[model samples]
Target: MYAWAARWRNAQRPKDQRLRDAERSGRPPDQRDQITQKLTALMSTTPTAHGYRHPNWTTPLLVAHLAREHQLEVSARTVRRALHGLGYRWKRPRFVLSRRDPNLRQAKGSSRGD
Candidate 1:
């Protein structure tokens, strides 16, 4: 296009600016920073404290909570992205054996024919 040619011809423009398309008018800001902040705070507390049955927080639960409390309409994907940006990683809960008996580990292994 002529516009692209003209833009490339301008020697005064920064090299980085040429690598991407120019910013244009678009949708209004989604206030992601504020939502991220709220999510951070919410992470500190359990869902039960907020009248939810589940103890852990899920993406859908977070989205519903935001809609209910902050009246913010955002997708679970957005919440996940924000969580990723905040350096949060998803880890499944692991089953932990109770320390009821000191020889429980030995008994378990022996019974399994190991």
Candidate 2:
């Protein structure tokens, strides 16, 4: 608590000498606006059109596609993060019983002893 108070007081000192967050030193922020736009556009279309054998875009598949098409080398995790940042979400394909026997319900009902 005392240390925190001292640090707070120091931060409140003269503006020039005041404590401030240190400049971040590392790989610069990934600003891939063009890539994000292309990704979103790709999402709007079927993956098949983009030469992907499958119809949906998985993170790994997207990563590979971006590398092949845009020459961008990125990880599947990075692709997923970028997609989420772009307000996109992953969706699983929904499966429904396409063909059902008309008498299936009746047959099940008759099979139940109760």
Best by TM-score: 1
Q: Cα lDDT of model 1 overall?
A: 0.87
Candidate 2: which stretches are off by over 4 Å? Answer: 1-31, 99-114
At residue 53, candidate 1 shows an lDDT of 100
In candidate 1, which residue pairs get closer than 3 Å at backbone N, Cα or C atoms, i.e. clash?
none
Q: Highest lDDT: which candidate? A: 1
The true-versus-predicted C-alpha distance at residue 89 of model 1, in Å, is 0.7
Per-residue lDDT, model 2, residue 85, is: 92
Residue 49, candidate 2: C-alpha displacement in angstroms: 1.1
Per-residue C-alpha lDDT of model 1 across residues 1-114, encoded as one tens digit per residue: 888878787778786675468689899888799988999999989999999999799999999999999999999999999989888889997788866886545555456565
For residue 80, model 2's alpha carbon misses the true position, in angstroms, by: 0.8
Give each model a TM-score: 0.65, 0.57
